[model samples]
Structure formats: structure tokens, C-alpha cells
Target: MHMTVCLVLAWILIYLCVMKGIKSSGKVMYITATFPYVVTTAFLVRSSTLEGAMDGLYYMISPDLNRLFDPEVWLDAATQIFFSMGLGFGGLIAFGSYNELKNNCVKDTVYLSIANLLTSLYTAIVVFCVIGFMGHQTYMDCLDNDYKTLMTLYPHKYGSLEELKTSIKLDEYIFWMEHQFHHSEFPLLSNASRYCNYKDIIASSAQGTGLAFVVFTEAILQFPFPPLWAVLFFLMLLMLGLGSMFGTLEGVITSLNDSHVITVKKPVLTAVLCGTACVIGLLFTTRAGQYWVSLFDHFAGSYALMCIAFFEIIAVIYVYGYRRFLNDLEFMTTERPGKYWTITWRFVSPVIMLILFFSSIIKSFSHHPVYSAYDPITTAQVDTAYPAWALFVALMLVSLALAPTPFIYFVRKFKIWKIEGDIPAASKCLGSTPSTTYMLKSEPSFNRMVESTASELQTIGMNGPSTNGSARNSENDRKGNGSNRHPPKRN
Candidate 1:
């Protein structure tokens, strides 16, 4: 029920922004894009100051330099970069389209990169800090623990069984439980003891997997100003998620819209697409809701972004012509784009993308564990099954692959997709528009007819100087003579 509401509300907000067009959606994007940074940063600062936080920070930053040589680490980093920056997938291009033609794409690109990097760093800190407090040795181990033990320990342990059963202050019970975990060395001790006490370990394990729903709800309920804080937190998350989603929807829609096959009526088209999304979302409300989401997320959110980023790099630096790209940078920063960006986009981006693509492909094909938990539908299996979720992801990838077919055909047929003939190109659509001449000449027949009609009007009502005769026109009047001025001449 909770996830359902969140999903519904999220789609509702995204659809509303689409109704406003890409330009208006910029406000939404800006807010959403910048928000997670603030939250994560705040949490990071708090986390970093906690005991043992430095150890976690060190663990994150001091990556095995050998991991760099392994190619997989580089791939992971690149994938993270692409996803965080909203690169590749039509999101960036669509957002860029919404920008002023004169707006600096190079600067925007750099700024976006820096912002994403900073956010990731902050997130890492927050993640590590929490893990450090939990005394987990590695990220994978922490993930295995499912981030629940800390949040739920207090609620389950601090309150007596009677207190838990009889308390009207459910929030207090949760708080009490969390406090126990916060102050206790149970998590660390569990790691040290290898969870020898099997019963307690199993209980802790159960809490970890269910934390997203259970403990998170408990934390929210226990807020000092529950109503206000809950409103703020949910609204903030909604804005952030919607902003990201708006970008994704806009990218896909623009890719189709620019082809001219979808028609140019943006308002109606946007509403329809968003409505369709809501209907699709309804599929996740059933018994396999989580499965559905995970499927879409795995494919569309991860690998798709990598592919998109690869193509984006190719388009920007190679196909667009690097010197021309340099000029875009010069216009924005008042200095030429550095050599580093050129190299990054050209050589580095593609290589990184390839590595990530191959790594995922290899992983999928390998006999490695699929790492999933038991659900109502299926027990925990060694290999992830081709469940509904997998099918969902497959559909998304297939759609992405096939999406350009009609678009390519349309552009070839109508020539509406050219940057000069079409509009400004960018990763994110940014209030982009057709060229001014295109706008003026769009109604070419009407313009031509108007000009012809004006000319014909000029030829009428000029027959004579005294009235409306052709003989006494401006030429005759200018010469101080009128061919039909004399009445004798009329006879």
C-alpha cells in the first residue's frame, strides 16, 4: 500500500510537469537534481563525524588501485558516472533541447559532471558512515545485511514485550528499538562472532530485508514533528524522483517527437504518454509489484544509461566535430573546452561504456549467484529466474533498441531531425525550438498568398486621379498629369 501510493503520486507529479512543457519542467528538474545532494551531504556530514566513520570513508576512497587495472572497477565507475549524470538516454538531449540555442552546452556538461560527482562522493560518505557505525568491513557485506539491523534493533529490543503489545505510542517503541541499535555493539559483535547465535542472527537478517518498508516507516513515525517532517521528506523525495523521471520521459518523448511521426502537439502528446506510464505502473500493484520495478530498473536504469552515454559521447565530440564542440565550450565559459574533456568523451567514454556493457553481459551469462531473496512467488534461488521483473527489463531494452527505427525512417523521409533543419540538440531537452526561419516559413503558402493578395490590392482602387481609374495612377500623378482627368477626352 505504501509503495503503491508513492508510485502513484510520483507518476502524477511527473505527468503534471510534462503538461507544462519541457521549459517549465526545468524548474522541477533544477529542484529535483539539486535536492539529493543536499540530503546526502547533510547525512554525510553527520555520518562522517560519528565514531569509526573515518575507517569507512577510507574503505570507500582507498579503492584497491589494482581494481583500476581489473577493468571491472573502471566499468563500474563509468556506469555510475553515466547514471548519476543522466547521460546517454535521451534525457540529457531532451533537457538540452529546452535550453536557449546560445546556451553553453559545454559549460552545462561540465557543471552537470561536477555536480553528479560531488553528489556521488557525498552519498559514498553517507553510505560508508552508516556501514562504519554498523562495523561492516565491506559494501557488499553491508548490502547483504540489507541496511535494516541498525534501524530496527532498538524497536524490537528496547521495549518490553508488553510495552510493544500495549503501547499507543508505536512511534516511541520504534525510537526505543533504534536507540538500542545505535548505542549497542550488537552489529559489530555479530560481525566478529560470525553471527554464531543463529536465532538472533536470523531475526536480524529478517529485519534487514524488510527495512525499506518497516524500519523506514518507523523512523518517519518517530519524527519529532511527524506531520511536518513527513510532509517535507516525502515531498522532497517526490520532487527528486519526479525530476529525474521527467528527464527520462522527456528524452524518450523528444526522440519520438522530433521525428515528426508523433506530431508536434506537445501538450496532448505528453499527457497521453504520462497516462500510459500510469497504466503501466498499475501492473506493479499486484502480487509481484517489487519484481516488476526491479526488472525495469535493472535494465533501463543501468545498462541503458551506459549505452546512451556511449552514443552521446560519440555524437558530441566525434560526429558533431570536435572544433565545433570547442566553440560551444568557448561560448559558455569564455575559454575553449580543455583537452581533458575531449579525450574523456572521445577515447575514455567509449572504452568505459564498452567495459561496462561487456561486464554486465558476462555476469548475466555466468553461473554466478543471482543474489535475490525469497518472495511470495519464489523461494531464494541460486540463479535469478526469468520472472516477471526480468521480462519487464527485457521489454524496456527491446523498446529502446526499436524506438529509433520509426524515428530514423521519419527523419530520412521528412528531414525534420537535423540540428540545423530540426532544432538545437542536447542530452536534456532544454526549451529547444525550431530555427527562426523554420518558424517563419512553416506557413509558407499562407505567407506567399498574403504577399500576392497585398500586391493585387495595390493594383485596385487606382483607375483615375479623380476617382479610381487606372490611367490616372501614381505614375501619371507624379508627372503632374492625368490621362483621364479631362471630361472631353472621355467622349
Candidate 2:
């Protein structure tokens, strides 16, 4: 019930924000977009002062140039770029469609792309700082706990606490302890013993939501005013999530409206769409929600995104004709696109996307879907693989986004063939086919009449009237100039 209420409220908020289309969302975005950055900046400033923060920053920016050659690194980088920019998703296209024809889309794209990358880097800095703090805290906890144990166990060897502390070399002591207590009967002792090593503390940190909620929250609790920082951190996350949801919902609404799939008032359509999404989202709120979310994240989010992107590039550059697209851009912008844009669109983007798409497919098939399952008692990841059937279902989920492209393409082609048989020649290039010749041929008489009328009008204009008739002829021509040009041909 709590989940349902949250879901409904979320949809309601989204509906309210975008019910009036881009106009409403555009106003709301001014706040939603800028506020997160402010929050992120605050977090970054606050986190930088924490103990061991520089270690995190070093870990993040220490570049191994050799990693560039690794396909896995490239794949990860490409995935981050795609998702961060919301490129493969229909949301960016839907948002852009609302722009005026004269709007400088090139400028907007360049600015937004740069902003997105910078924002990602900034967020990473904040995240790793928090992680570094966590690492530091964990290391201290392990150090103190192990130090107490050492004092308790070897009090006789060292005469007094000060003497033992002065005599012990911390690093060598930790190494000796870890080797000594490697398989202690007490689980807590064993775990604490392991953490005495700095590498173990670093290894314990997680990624994704675990890092956000678990690790960061843990770091927040160690701060001067825990509650204040906690609230601020959570608020930042909520705003970020809401901003993303707004764009995603807007994409669905815009697509539906453009396709004429739901012919209703905007508010009514918004309600229906949001309500439907909320209902579907209920699945993720269930007990096994994490599993389902992970499944979707793997198959639908990652794999399908790349596939959709690949096809989108192909359809635009190859199917729609890149040169014609550029011409259309020229018409709108009053300037031709540069060779850089043309080359990237025509070749570079498509080839790289195609490679990524196939690589993802190969990777998906090669490895079984195995998510880190946490043990409730230990809060440690268990080595448990998802069932085969669940992976199969995930594959089906991937097809949900991908299956429509080819299906819609064939459907459109069939409709064209049905309406205009033998009109569009097979050899004729897409978007470059001459005006339907078959339609023109079928109305030869009307065409001839129109041609004759145009010729007569031209002759009248060329052959100057007699001096007496000149004024009256010119007056008639002035009154009927538009009609004389090219009247609509009747069947």
C-alpha cells in the first residue's frame, strides 16, 4: 500500500508537470534542472573536507592509459555516454520536436552534451569522496577493534599499554594479525581482522544504489550533523529522480500524441498514461522487486538501449538519406552543416554504435545473468545466479523496445504499396523519389489543361496590350494575378 501510494503520487506529480505538454514542463524544468546541481555542489563541498577524501579523488582520476585499449572499458564509457545524454531514448527527440524550426539545435546539442559530461564528472567526484570517507571510517573501526584485541591477547608480552603501542609497527602488526586470525571461530573477529588491511576496506565498497544509499548514508551518519546531511542527500536524489521521470514520461506522452494512438484531451491522455505506468510500476514494488529491477536494468536498459540506438542511426543516416537530412537542416538553419557533422553522422556514429550493439549481444549470450544477492544476516553478496527462465524473460523484455522498429517499418511500407501500387519504384532512393509519376500520369487531361492555361497567361503577359487596352488589361491582370498563376486541377 505504501508503494502504491508513492507510485500514484509520483505519476500524479508527473502528470501535473507535463499535462500542458512542453509549456508546463519547460517552466518546471527551470527549477528541477538547476536545483540538483546546487545540491550536488553542496555535497561535493561538504564531502571534500572528510577524512581520506583526496584518496577517493585520486582513485577516480588516476587514469591508466592502457585501459583505453580494453574493449570492456570502451564499452562501459560508451554506455555511460549514451545513458547520460539520453541519446538512444526517445526523450531527447521528443523534447527537440517541441523546438521552433529556427531554433539553433546544433548549439543546444553541443552545450547540453558538454554540460552532461561535466555534471557526470562532478557527481563522480562527490560519490567517490563519500566512498573514500566510508573507507577511512571502516579502516579506523577495524584498526581500533583489532588494536583492542591485540592488547587483550598479548598483555603479558608487553609490560604496559604505552609500551605495547610504542613497540608495535601498525602495518606489520596488521599483517601478522591477519595471518594469525585468518580462520578465527568468531565471525565478527574474522571480519574485523580482515578489515585491519586497507585493501579489504576498499574492496568492501559497492557501486550503484548500494554506494548511494548504503555507503553514502553511512558516511553521512559520521558527519557533524547527520540528520541535516541525510535530508539534503535524499532530497538531492529525489529531485534528480523526478527530473529523469519527467523527461521519460514526456517522451511517452509526446509519442502517443504524435502517432494519434490516444485521441483524447491532453490532460485525459496524461492521466491515462501515467495511471497505466503507475500500475505497471507496481510490479517493481513487490517483494522480488530488486530482482525484476536488476533484470530490466540488464536486458531492457542496457542491451535494448544500444540496439535501439544502432537502428536509429541506421534509419536516419542510411534510410532517410543523410544528405537530404542535411538539406532539411540547411532549410531550417539558413546554413549548411559542416563536414565534421556530416562525417560523424554518415560514418563514425553508425559504425561505433553497430560495434557496441553486437558486442553487447555477444556479452549477453556469453555470460549468464547473475546479480549480487545479499545475505540478510551478513549483508554480504551471495554467489547465487538467477534461474534460466528469469534470464529468458529478460530477453523478452529487451525485445519490447526493439521489436517495434522493423514491424512499423514493414507496416508503413505495406500501407504505401497498398495506396499507390507500382508508384514508388524499387530503384528510387528513399526521400529522393520524384513526385509520384503514376498519380500524375493518371490525370493527364487535367495536367494538360493546367499547362495550357499557364502558357496562355504567359503569352498574355509577354504580348503587351494595345495602347487603348493596356490600362484595362493591366487592371484585370492585377485583380486576378494569383488565380492566373496555377489554379488547382480538378479530376
Global lDDT of each candidate: 0.52, 0.67
- List residue ranges in candidate 2 displaced over 4 A: 64-73, 159-163, 169-192, 376-378, 416-491
For candidate 2, the per-residue lDDT at 252 reads 77
Best by lDDT: 2
For each candidate in turn, the TM-score is: 0.60, 0.79
lDDT of 2 by residue, 1-491 (tens): 89778878877888888777766777888888888888889888889999989887877787778877655556667777877787777788767754444456778988998898889888999988888888878887777666666567666677876676677766756666667643453334454444465545765688676787789888888888899988878877777777787788777765565443455766788788888888889998898877777777766777788788888878877876777677656644568899999999888987887777676567656776478787999878876787989877987898788898888778666654232211121111111112222223344443454354554333222232112211111112312112122233334
Q: In model 1, which runs have C-alpha deviations exceeding 4 angstroms?
A: 1-6, 29-76, 133-232, 253-259, 316-320, 323-339, 368-371, 375-399, 402-491
